[model samples]
Target: MEASGYLLSGVLTGLFLLGTVLVLARNRNWQHYSPAGDASGVGETVERLAGSPGTWIGGFVLLTLGLGLGTLVVVGGLPVPEGVQGAATVAMAVVVLAVLAGYVFLGVYHSVRYRGLYRSQAAAAGIWIVATLAVAGIAVMLLTAG
Candidate 1:
């Protein structure tokens, strides 16, 4: 149980870090077409990345992390740290919600900004945001009861 909790924590951390990097990559045109400024082939490039298998794979990874974390918390019977119930639970929920919201905003903005590469990439990001929120909600519930 402890190992699972540790694994889940690591997964969550990695997902957060990866999401951050993906946002930056889109913003900086790092994930855009190679030969950066070439507007001609940009559409094709964007389309490929947006619908790439990699995006789906990454989304699944995030979803798994969220589910895994929630499961670990339940199975391990971990209690919320003292004084972290009620409003504190609400506070943690808010923080996690904010993170998920930020991810969504980033995904939408990036999709619109780079319409060419919008589909796959944006879907992948969106999935992570949704998964994160779901897991965060469960985490808060578990913590609140403890």
Candidate 2:
């Protein structure tokens, strides 16, 4: 049941992130953009940011860190040791911070063309981060207390 709770929370978090990305893409007019064509200045900026290698790298890092930590908690059999809940809480806070940083990066990276999208992304990212933290908090509480 605990594992299920964690998995469910993670899935929900991912879905929210995906939705935010989709909305950002749409708002930025990047839904079907082609960087190889007649792109205006704004389009060029969009292409540069959206097609940036750094975005992909950041995404990869997020994927790796999230999976790595989750795997450690599950496979390493590191049950919430007594008094260690603080550590788990801190770690979740860090994850939330990372998510916020990523959103900021996305916004700044594309600010040249997608200012509106950046704002939307920031709002959506905040929502997702809060939701994830809430779920993770619940999971940790259950794991530690139960």
In order of appearance, the predictions have TM-scores of: 0.28, 0.28
What is candidate 2's local distance difference test score? 0.66
Worst 10 residues of 1 by lDDT: 81-90
Report the C-alpha lDDT of model 1 over 1-146, residue by residue, as the tens digit.
86578669867887898899778877864445435565698888888987999987997688667555554454444576544334445554565676667667676757654876555566676666677667766766765664
The per-model lDDT (C-alpha) reads 0.66, 0.66
Per residue, candidate 2 scores C-alpha lDDT tens digits across 1-146 of: 87778769768987997898788767844444334666468877877888999987997798778757755664444776645555655676677676666675555546533555455555665555556666667767876774
